[model samples]
Target: MSDPVRCMTVCRVCGKEDWLDVLSFGPMPLANNYLAPAPSYDDEPRFPMDVIVCRSCWLMAIRQVVSPDVLYRHYVYISSDSRQILNHMRDVANLAVTRFHLPAGSLVIEVGSNIGTQLEVFRSMGMRTLGVDPARNLADLANARGVETLAEYFGEGLAGTILEQYGHPRLILGRHVFAHIDDLTDVINAATRLLDPAGIFAVEVPYLLNLIEGNQFDTIYHEHLSYFSVGTLRRLFERHGLRVVDVARFAVHGGSIVVFVGQAESQWPTGKAVFELEELEVRSGLTNEVAYQRFAERSGRTMRELGALVRGLVSQGKRVAGYGAPAKGNTLLNACGITARELQYASDTTEFKQGKVLPGTHVPVVSPAYAHDHPPDYFLLLPWNYAKEIIGREKSLLEQGIRFIVPIPEPLVVSNESLKDAAFSLSHG
Candidate 1:
């Protein structure tokens, strides 16, 4: 008999209580990266791929499960892939050290330090640094760069070991890693234990408001077990003996919030930005199911419009392919009901994912070189946040006659010639 099909109709955060049937993105496959059908794995199971809102807490999450080991191991995503990110990290590192007045030899520990990108910035500042990450290849790679990395999944046990061996960290940082852990209790407890009495925990996650307001349903894939708003975060951290003191919005990953946390009883006043978010959540009835129902309604509409636009292009005999093979792209593709047949392929600069196919859709990923050699009629920029960067870099290809298509907010068609010199222009202006 085949494995039983699992479906989710309730809220995960509040369990069965205040269960709100928000929005369903319909059936989507396991979108970490599509694996090929091999004799060793003849028939693999796919999840329900539905995301529901907890009417009680208003937290949004996927309704399926993927082993953490399989999700993170042999990871392909790298932090240093974009030039914009490099600059962002540089500024963030300098700001962090100066704002906190981090003394020399003060420990700065990063959880999910992918390839040691940000920590390397810290090392340049003469600070003691440690990276705790689960991915074996990434840990090995970080170690190769002379950055001390522990290849173990982080929890209370790892925190215990760290406290025993290295003492408490002055700064604990996690970017895009905070929402990855489902069992937040263990990691939050571990972080509290690993923190110095006066230590600060800095986390960057996609703000739940932005995810809803901007229609970023793609961020709700299997890897992300929780979507956090300031309200939800306040309750979560306080329960774990940690206090969230500040929140800052960043342009990275579409729109993200960097929350600065400390021990729960600490006397730090909440930042104005944090208060603004809290009030926003209150106005939206963040703890109620009504807001989620409205958000879900709009999201389905957006997805349909996007799908119609793409399909219209296909019906016109235009050759369309995608740019930037991102996890968010999986959600966009899935929401738009895009099959491999609709998009010829997606080109990624990341060598690790270049040759591998997309996790569930089976859309092959190619290098930017593939576009140069076999230019298509349209280049669909799925990671539209980095559209300006990608479009600028691929100006040479546009010079050879390839058009750029951006699908966010709404589908817009633009040319590379005008945007080719944009980064420099933005810098000078």
Candidate 2:
């Protein structure tokens, strides 16, 4: 049998034993582990989702660490699925090439490059690109698309192999992947070894400040081992002989911060963005325990509010189905104890999730075409981060008097009138 999931004893960044309990969602199923219709809940796996913070480095992370093999080997999240993400990646690629002045044929490597979408952008820009991802299916697709990808977990050993075969990379970028890593130091060391002396390592992770401020408790799951802030990232990179040279914030993935790191001895200029964000982190109470306590309380309130809202709608004989079956959606559903009784089914575009039921709630996932054929009274916006884009996409349904329930930060129902006003504000503002 597989070993039980283990609790973290020391901080991954500072190796300190000091820890502060932040929040607990009791036991939750693996957020991305969509099950077949046949699997019984009695046999389904669940683990503790206790979030904690390191008092020494102020790094927030989950106490239990699930094995990466079970979490990522057969992943279903496709980066190319979202149009907004594609545009964001295009922007990221263009900025990296132009801002860094990456000449043609410069080797660029991406860790956890899902389906090689972003790396393909780099390849199109005349740069040599390599992608390292653990998902064999995605790696195969990436290779078929001409973006040479390796289906291997990256660490010190694989870093040596890549260095020998592909030479040192001019840029090593990981988008939303660093937070999933359990061994931050090992990954940082591997990155440091695989990079050229003058190269830069850019990592984009969900900003901790954004999580607390936006009350994005749904983003917490077992796969995401760590939550980062500019301050914690600075400490993490510095311990591995790398320095944060630059930082930028983006609204994608709720909110994320891309930190640019370089070898400490390198002459890369530290941008004002780094210092400015670090100060902001301190002023926002990210470096203290009180903020976490408040966040925990707020998360509980959100769960209760969302539960009451959905239950109320069900009592009125309203048919509510979830829109978008993202991993975070599973966390929210399980945490709030919402099941198939509340949400009939979750509609998604991803074929991999269409026939499978949600991790714990047993809410069957359906295709968007099927959902449209059998429309519900309200669509519980599961991926609330893209509320505007999703609401705009279903304009016809909105015009037909179908409302949407957005459950995050608070539970709010969106109607045609509200959407029009929002669109007008966006256009005029």
lDDT of each: 0.76, 0.89
Number of the top-ranking candidate, with TM-score as the measure = 2
Off-target runs (Cα >4 Å) in candidate 1 are: 1-16, 36-44, 284-290, 396-401, 416-429
Tens-digit per-residue lDDT, 251-320, candidate 1: 7777788888988776556678878988987887676676777777777777888788778888999888
**Clashing pairs in model 1?**
33-359, 34-358, 34-359
All-Cα superposition RMSD per candidate: 3.7, 1.8
lDDT top scorer? 2
Prediction 1 TM-score vs. true:
0.89
- Where does candidate 2 stray beyond 4 Å? 421-429
After TM-score superposition, the amount by which residue 419's alpha carbon in candidate 1 deviates from its true location, in angstroms, is: 6.6
